[model samples]
Target: MITTVRDYLAAHRRAKDAFPGALLLVVSVFASMAGPSGWHGPRAAPVLWTAAACAPLVWRSRAPVLVTVAVASVEVVHLASAPGQPLVPGASLIALYTLASRLPRRRAWVIGLVVTVALTVALAASRSDEVFAAGTLASFDLLVLSVALGDLTRSRRAHLAALSKRAEQAERTRDDEAARRVTAERVRIARDLHDVVAHHITLVNAQAGVAQHLVRTDAEAAYQALGQLKDNSRAALDELRATVGLLRQDDDVSEPRTPAPTLADLDDLAASFVHTGLPVQVTITGALRPAYPSIELAAYRITQEALTNTAKHAGPGATARVHLDYGDTALRVEITDTGNGVRAADMAATDGHGLIGMRERAAAFGGTLTAGPGRGGGFRVVAELPLPQDPGDAR
Candidate 1:
């Protein structure tokens, strides 16, 4: 409750503006009684000086320089009128401190020094006997203490402002990073969808056309083509489900039922290609160790994209080979086709999004991918992905 009240008053502009004036008024009342003649006595000159000194304090915080001048002029007049007597200290102290806090450091320091020196000279000229007295020393001490206090307040406010600025900058950086990641993830999902749909749908279209043509003349062949069509459709649906699973929120309980494709699914992948009239030979070298989920998925997608490219460009009577070699430090994948259909010109002219997506996927796992015409005749794709040293790091 107390903290709430303090915060409310701190934000209230009128309350803040009134505080300095009220404090100065109270101080002036006290200083008036300290004169040679008490407040109860008829001392019109001291009362007048006190009023003049404190009156300018109403604008002290708002116009510190103007207030300082007004107060200092009144103090000098009081000193000149009543020699060897000090005017009220509250008005000069308030004005000097307020000026120091509001102004720049260099200017504040200069102002504080000038004010202190001017007051000391005026007081000293009034009484040579009491120039070096304890009262004079106390007066100087008060002026120094006020400037120091104001400088301290200024430093603290500047530090807080700096901290607030850094915090805001950090927040903006975090927001930008999050937006970039979201954009990258959206692009990844679109690529995955394209790979899955393009491969299966192409096979489906071809098989559907074959079944339609052979249904009247060759029933058995048409039935076989129809079976392949159904298989291709199922595969497309399964892949779509798997890829779509990635889009679910973390709290989503109902994710896609189908599991993500991995190296283990390579045989199924090869079988699908065989049914599509392309003979694919998959060779695995070295002991297959458990790999990171992302690496395994990347390897699967790279192979799928390579085979899709082969199906699209390798032409008839072409044979394709997929080699997976697990080295001590990395996993190497190479896919080659022995079809002259994919000419050097075709590979050179290729600037398709599929190749770009494949390269991005490989690069995500600290891997590298190279694709071009094979040494003898067809197309080739080679990818190498670095492996974690510890088996436990596979996740």
Candidate 2:
């Protein structure tokens, strides 16, 4: 029965208002019957006054000032009609509390003081012999206490509301940050796949053509071309497997079979192009030193993409040169071809995916990449990647 009543009060606002007033009326009526100087006239007068005072409390929250005035006025009349009744009515206290919590501090205090003074004066007047009795003083104290408690409740509610808003903002910020990281990871994976597939597949297609042509003429050269095709295909598969491994969830137990390619693998990279009948000469101008793995990988992929573009678009009889220069602050990688490749105008008009990927990779590492026709003739791709101040910091 208790749980059912509690649920009904929680669900209904009208029930919350009526429950307290109903209980106060019932308790006040019962207590009035036992008082020493109760009901000097008709016994029903004091009961009617008590019921009237408590009834206004049902609208205390809705019209606190009016409700408080009405209740206090009725209590004063009740005290005059019956002298030695309860000094403070419970309904009056409830009304004062509602007024303090819902209104501003200065206004609430002003109104509360006025009501407290009015009730205290009425109580003292009812007891003509004892003007400043213990009951009058105690009634004043209870009224002030109710107002203080109401203001405290209001402050606590405000504090909890502010805390709830802050928590929601923090959760939203975390979700946005997670989404950004996921998008960046997706773009990085796409670039890796593009570089791997484009570079090796171009070689495989060229080698297959060479083998088909040579098989009709020179059997030995055709066998060598076929062998190079097999190697290029295997290399493509290994790099693809490594790039795809990044998609696995954190709980995944599998690991990539091959390590990421770096500048150290440049020789093997150039040899693959050489087998496709393109002459590539790699030149190093400065002292070789360790660099960040990400930096080296970007440089290697940039070089590979540049050379692949040269072989595919640079007319026949094209020879490409790759230069690596390690300096005090940065590492420079440049690829240039002798054959007249796509003109600058045409390259700009097309805006191929390879150039976009290269630029993105360089930008990711706080570096820069520029691609266009070289000074004399042919295509050129130059990427400048910053090196760490201390070589030991390279990872």
Candidate 3:
């Protein structure tokens, strides 16, 4: 109940209930006085002193030191005129506390000490009150303590407010960053979808037309075209689902599709090349672990692109060597095919987008890649993918 009342008063004092009560407090303290000689000595109208003391409270927040001096002066006069009644010590104490808390501690202590000493001396000279009242000094002590407490409270509140504001600002920054990343990712997925869909759609439509044309002439060739179309369409559907569902799925969206090709599947990749009547040797220098999804995908694409180029440019009997070296910091793969040893100018002049895409994949993982002609005789592609610290580090 005491705490509740105090909180209520503090709220009211800051807002509405302070002014009227303050005026009354000033009046009640100075309204009547017993003169210095036990005869209401040197008594003047109490109303003037009341107004003088009350005037300072209005300036409490703006001019703490000046208001304090004014209130102290009025209190000394009242004490001189009447030593009989106990001065209420009301708003003066409040103003004194505000002064101490609002001002620097050293300044408050200096001013408060001066007020105490001067008041004590005046009372002594008047022979009205003693320089040292048995219990009167306690109020002055309370005043000094109030200064320290007020200063401490102000510092604490300011620090907390600063910290809270910084935390809120940081949270807003994180949310904005996340939103930007999401937008970029969505845009990237859209582009990938367009390419993947468009490429396979063209193939499927062309093959379907071939199948329809051959239905009357050679059924075998038509069936072969239809089979290729089925495979192409299914692959496109599965890959699209994997890429698109990444945005919608909650669990393990980072995980690639179940049959997603890894370095382990490089044998199958090699078989495809070997079936094309090329001498393709895949050499694994070290044990290959299941790498991060992104790294694995990059490695696979690099290998596949290199092999496809060998078949297209190196002719049927060209020798190809794919070297996969797993190292401490990164996985290095080199694909060299005897594709008439592309000249520096030729590699530079080759299709623009393939080289750009390959470089993009390498850059995404802070890796490096270089493609040019081998010193012996052929085009060579070298890709180095820096292995991540793994998901455990993230956890």
Candidate 4:
């Protein structure tokens, strides 16, 4: 019984249908009043008629036009029979406003105009003093105002919802852009670290071979190579520290830094590789134009890595040539080693991209790179990187 009552009440609330329900209750009370005390009526069956008239109010919002017609018709009869009574036209007013607010501009206007005219006409014919007068026109104006208010409230709600959705989409777009930038930066650091460290590692490998061979034959050469080993080890560590430290900065807890190596340090690079017992030929063919530091750094790394690869895969009998040709539009690098040819299957092991990290360095500067067996039996790597506008440009 409790559940059934709750459900009935819930359904009633949804329709409120209760507007008509309460009106029915009031009409019943009025009918009882008319019968008991100072009542006089030849048209006796009183309150039931009023209650029946307002029954349609329960579905006013559901069928506004039908509800309006029924209430207006009953009110008309009640006015003709009795001169005075509290005939609440609440149901008609509610229906008229609902139709006007919900329907489109032209439809709402047509419906509202027809209903208003009908109500006025019905009121003029009624014998009741309660018939619509000039004051009723004021009530009609208020019906239109209520309709406009509901429409305005709906429009504002829609506008706010759209703005909220747009803000959420913008935040998602910002997050995606941040993720892309982070990925690009990591690729750049990987390229830089590979270039800077690979060359020094190659030097260590080549010198280790020389010193090992000479330590049993020539004592003087052995002593010199052992010293060179220490220098090479320290140099590699210093370069790694500088490049890595540049990438890792915590302003809250960092010491002052010194300058890092750049293209100007290429002379020292060429000399160190030569000390490793491999003959390297250097050639610069550009018109002496400066490039972006990142681009130049890219160039330095490419050359260094290529030489390192040549020293690793090619035997000591191989001769490596380094070329830096600067064109009007771009800078070019070519490292050719005249050594035994590498098999296609051994590529993953003996190729320049393997240990020297050529492919990664080339990608960092938006450059094109190619590495393969030379025309005869050796190996070659070529890269083309864009140049900066001015000859004095750097960084």
Candidate number of the best lDDT? 2
Flag the better candidate by TM-score, 1 or 3.
Answer: 1
Please identify model 3 stretches exceeding 4 Å from their true place: 1-51, 80-85, 123-130, 169-226, 249-259, 267-294, 305-321, 326-330, 338-367, 376-378, 385-395
Model 3 C-alpha lDDT per residue in residues 42-72, reported as the tens digit of each score: 3345555656677667767677888889888
Residue pairs with colliding backbones in model 4 are 293-395
List ranges where model 4 is wrong by over 4 Å.
1-134, 246-252, 256-260, 343-345, 349-366, 392-395
lDDT of 1 by residue, 1-395 (tens): 97986787589755664566566666655665664554554345666677778777767778888888888878877787788775546678878888888888888888888888777667766655455777777787888788888888889999999999999999999999999999999998998997898789868876787798899999999999999999899989988987888888889888547777889999998888887778999999987788898899899988998888888788778889999999998999999999874753464466266687788999988889998888888899999998878888997
What Cα-based lDDT does every candidate model obtain?
0.82, 0.86, 0.69, 0.69
Query: What's the TM-score of each model vs. the native?
Result: 0.87, 0.87, 0.66, 0.67
Q: Model 4 over residues 215-254: C-alpha lDDT tens digits?
A: 9999899889989988999888777776667667566456
* Model 3 pairs in collision: 35-40, 35-41
**Lowest summed lDDT over 10 consecutive residues: which window, candidate 2?**
34-43
Q: Model 3 — which ten-residue stretch has the worst lDDT?
A: 34-43
Candidate 1, residue 225: Cα displacement in angstroms equals: 2.4
Candidate 2, residue 194: Cα displacement in angstroms equals 1.6
Q: Give candidate 3's error at residue 359 in angstroms.
A: 4.9
